[model samples]
Target chain A: MTTLRRVTLDVLKPHEPSMLAFTERVAEVESVDGVTASLIELDQEVQNVKITAEGAGLDYDAIEAAVDGLGGTIHSIDQVAYGEHVVEERRTLQDG
Target chain B: MTTLRRVTLDVLKPHEPSMLAFTERVAEVESVDGVTASLIELDQEVQNVKITAEGAGLDYDAIEAAVDGLGGTIHSIDQVAYGEHVVEERRTLQDG
Candidate 1:
């Protein structure tokens, strides 16, 4: 079975549980190596944010449970990577 | 009981499942009224994204399951709103 290495999600949430508190909560999830949260947009009651997480063996379910327990919803699953040793794929532009 | 109306998250994902494909998959979740995805940043192997979803009685579990099924992970719960008739909270600057 392929192990998940990294995952990205788009999430929308209410305003009370401040983003700082929320980030701290998610970062504590088991197997999550690191987390970075950036605010994309905000209105009167909600804020749109991008959640990026990376780790050796990411636990999708644990991460989900943490977000749910905190009263947040995932809008979209933006990206994913899996394998024994997942590495960021990068390539330089080749001029024709 | 409080009902969730909107949620925002920060996510990091791999490059294969194009953001468009990812968004399309997320939009299909039950109780999700609408989905908007915007690209935040990209590297050789991964892309960071912000996903916003709005709806009545939003299902955090379904959303999370769908994203995980599609190979994404929730990095952080950025914001959350709950209660009846959830309304965007906006306040004008009052003169001091």
Candidate 2:
């Protein structure tokens, strides 16, 4: 079985829930062992954050629903890793 | 003692040694468990690569020496994680 080990997403969320609270909510999702959300930018209305979630076999839909429950919108799924372990993305020359 | 878990470096090296050979050489270092090298750029003279080495307790000086032995210069140490486990770098809003 192809297991999702990690995922990184760009998300936009309201300021009502603090970053700590938001991270805790995501970490509570089943299959998720850990979650980290870093504030990228923020305005009066919303904040942009980069979120990374890791697990043995992450369920994307469940994670999405959890983010939705917090009134957050996922801008993009930046990176994903599947299989026996989480493989980090290597920046190629084209990234420059 | 704080153990070095992982290190990502920008390296420049001659085309003589293939990426596979370079990675293998680095992986052979005393404390490194695994090493991955991705081609970032290449010219007639040299190839620029992004190298990530991981282990329970990585020795940076030894890794540097291995690269040096291969006629590779460590352009920059982009990232380093020292702890119980490897921590991914979280991109923040200020990154933009």
- Candidate DockQ scores, in order: 0.02, 0.04
lDDT by residue (A1-96, candidate 1, tens digit) is 335556778888788588998888889998999989889899997888888887876788788787788788887666665433433322112101
Query: How far in Å is the alpha carbon of B47 misplaced in model 1?
Result: 17
Question: What C-alpha lDDT do the candidate models reach, one value each?
Answer: 0.69, 0.78
Chain B TM-score against the true chain B, each candidate: 0.83, 0.95
Indicate the worst ten consecutive residues by lDDT in candidate 2 chain B. Answer: B32-41
Rate residue B71 of model 2 by lDDT.
Answer: 97
- iRMSD for every model: 13.7, 8.7
Write candidate 2's Cα lDDT for A1-96 as tens digits: 345667778899999788888889999999999998888999999999999888987887899999999999987565555444554655433356
Interface DockQ of candidate 2: 0.04
